[model samples]
Target: MTRCRLCGSTALESVVDLGATPPCESFLAAERLDAPEPTYPLHLRVCTDCWLAQIPPLITPEETFSEYAYFSSYSSSWVEHARVFVEDAAARLGLGEDSFVVEVASNDGYLLRHVVDRGVRCLGVEPSVNVGAAAREAGVPTLTAFLSPETGAAVRAEHGPADLVVANNVYAHIPDVIGFTQGLRALVADDGWVSVEVQHLLTLIEENQYDTIYHEHFQYYTVASAIRALASGGLTLVDVELLPTHGGSLRLWARPEEAAGEPSGRVADVLAREKAAGLQELSGYTEFSARVAKVRRDLLRFLVEAAEEGKTVVGYGAPGKGNTLLNHCGIRPDLLPYTVDRNPYKHGRYTPGTRIPILPPDRIAADRPDYVLVLPWNLRAELVEQLSYVHEWGGRLVFPIPELSIVEVER
Candidate 1:
């Protein structure tokens, strides 16, 4: 009788278990070196009542992003993605000078910058203090507070309702999914649409993307599950599109539930596909645990053999996803040595469970490692470009996912 995030429905069954994992951004301190890192149950379950998919009830949003270090602008791929999204959303919405755009979790104004350029009034609602400050400094009007029903009401009282709301990759991070969507309901006008991007749960299970599991990610979503979740908060899907971001994701366009439009062919098609794929049945997800177990075995084998061969395997990216992969795989400082990050905040901090020091990208050039273990597999291409200097030394890039192997040429 597991309760669903959308409603208080107790019709959930366990689907996948990613095992015990440490907090993604819980960097260790020198004094706490010997102290044991807190590990939480890393399991994803599907709510049959509401069709929503999420991790077990555990950490809060404040516990996750209040002192967050992973800023969106640090990664070029993400920044470019934001720019493109803003352009497409603006055009699709047919925004004009009078229309307003609001972006939830708009870190460093990566996406809002484009909205601002089109003479469309734009504002950002970001909870993280540091990231919000960065956005304001970039001339993006940002509110530095958490979004709830009260905050949404206060915002509307000041600036009226928004016409376009963008919640990119923030759907999975919200602690109170229903409460957050209710805020969106209050913050947006009747004619407006909210485009939300959540990591696709179908992709996570089907592709064995267990590495994406972490406390920061409160929920993984499928199109069917998301539509149901939004429906609970008085919203309905206007359209939906499958996205390739973060391995696999979905961009859902939803509006107020009252004024229902003709259902998109995309919606019915995916529903039929999921039904054919047995989404409603619990047994369909039972094999996810076994798939995860195999991944753990293959990854450990690769890392151990590489260490024995005297390969200096440095890690790329200090992402939350990378933390889950490293800690779950039991990689310590002996095997990984150090990881490089583009952000200055995490450069000196050590990873949570593994306690491996995080250094700047310059470490790769200085150390001249024989092998670079790309932690954030989605950004492997960017890492390869940034670390092309290593190629001069005949170094190879390794991606440990689906299967473990080294890429000799540019992939």
Candidate 2:
């Protein structure tokens, strides 16, 4: 964009241009296959002033989240991650029956269910109607609305200031970063804790995780930039924890400035790491574009060689990141043929730009394909165990990110 979304600065440098592609989560129905699909420029830039990396606000949250297809409960590891977070947060924050908990963008009540089980009052503020309905059906109180300054204040007034506000994997989804952060401030008590988990830009660059950049993710944050973003809404970063989720992520603990005394040593430690990695300057981003090009070349080469050898190569998991990888590499059904997923909503649909069919998880076993190209490589550990049956027929699993590697499962 001409101006940075966060700092409003006119100086924005190129990080990587992923070319134009449709929304990553936009799966096409059979009826719409013949119709035309729209695409937008997927260029990511970093602001020279604030060092915040972002893409243009080409798509709005309403367009994507109104009836979102992603369900957090589909990933067993993610659900367990949520459960453990709830347990730890409860014990750490001294939450009990009297504590009020609120989770923004909570999908399908995966995390809040643990809070509900503990008999604490909790609510999920989600924008997607389908997932929010699923949350309600699971006995979790849910509000089907987007988070804003006014919305957060209303929640605080009606239910009283929340003791704990959990926002996981959603800090980068909203375009209005300032407004969204203000909403978080409004929902939390003056002394309450706000926990946010987002993909770490440092690891994203070091690990060659460019596929994570998509239209839905508006911005990527380093600890330094994240500190500035938090202060924009009067929230102070008090603690920071590095997590292994989403390849690599940061768990930020914040509070209102009045109660946020001094940041923990971890904050400085992360900032130091970011500085050493050259993220605070322009040098870190200079080689990213070249590295990204290498990844695309390597993946396309593998698919071509596999085809020539008569080795069938299909995909596993139709995640949004997978769509980014597919569209960037210009892969179609000719190369990938089809993919399988656990979410039933995508069973009969096709990936937006690539037009690859999505089938059920059992199809891999039924067809016994020679090779299964895994799209959701972030869930490598959990998916490997789930797909160990591939070993029965000598079928192998392929991972495309951080480097392309093939695994021979031994059951």
Candidate 3:
């Protein structure tokens, strides 16, 4: 029996079994495709004790993130998101030149650049050397090490405690939930706050976002479970905000337990909402597998019908989430001939399990496919706007998640 990573409970109930899947971000080179690739069981479980939804760590962190391919600067909307966050956070926290900010899992300095521009001292803790080098080139000093309790203590010794520590979209990626939260506590000043952003478990089930389930993500957290995990590290939740990014994400503001701060009503409000949705009970999770299976069947039917009709279908954005959707649905190059991406690192490569070639955005206009499958459905609006020229050829966009639907482009 696999124990819960957070609470160490042995009573883990099965939620959804996605069979075996490769690491979502593991793009393959042309030569490597001929060789066998490693895949792990993509199964999720819920702990009755803590109510934390998680998957067992099949691959080690070194194997998954040492040479990361995803870069934050590739998406214009993501960069804008970072800029807005830095602006709002700096203003809200009263950050100045004297204030020190540290970002964990900082990718390419997409967010910290704004903090540096504001004259606040900032440091980034990044594990991927390639991405870390990019951040350094952009004038963001970064330490190329994983954020563990030991490393966090070393950072504190070298640079002093941070006035504000930001960990956006990285809370779920960590395998050691308790250790990671403790590390955050170690790095933050006594009075400073730690801001963590994670995709809400409620939104994941409501929207049928099963594609977000990949090997790198160790846990899916609800507001209540998140509060429990943070409290284990001697942190208290002070505030919470729901965000629209990544389907629906929750940004949590927490401080050391000894710190003087009252918990915001939003925290209780969201916790109550989760309870109303039956998230506190096991029955709330039992129906999810059926919903996910329906999505897979519906998407496959749409793709098979399109193929039989001799329609040329291609994919947009080779994101990790897209890989999960394609691999889970057993899609290959025949269904989606190829995909386009703005990130140069993924342009010449192929997706891990599906083996679909990834090309540059210019390929979409060159091919003028009859239908473009938007793989990263969360960014549908941005993609539709960028690929608007496809409408000139009477081509429509297809979204596979939350039910397969065809969207007509407005001329």
lDDT of 3 by residue, 154-175 (tens): 9999999999999998999999
| C-alpha RMSD by candidate, in order | 1.7, 0.6, 0.9
Q: 155-273 in candidate 2: lDDT tens per residue?
A: 99999999999999999999999999999999999999999999999999999999999999999999988999989899999999999999999999999999999899999999999
> Mind sharing the TM-score for model 2?
0.99
lDDT of 1: 0.82
Q: Locate the minimum summed-lDDT window of 10 residues in model 1.
A: 402-411
TM-score of predicted structure 1: 0.95
Q: Can you tell me which runs of candidate 2 are displaced by over 4 Å? A: none
Worst 10 residues of 2 by lDDT: 1-10
Model 2, position 249, has a per-residue lDDT of 98
- TM-score for each candidate, following the candidate numbering: 0.95, 0.99, 0.99
For the record, the alpha-carbon RMSD of candidate 1 to the native fold, in angstroms, is: 1.7
Error of 2 at 291 (Å): 0.7
lDDT of 1 by residue, 127-160 (tens): 8888889988888899987788888889888998
How high is the CA lDDT of each candidate model? 0.82, 0.96, 0.91
Clashing pairs in 3: none
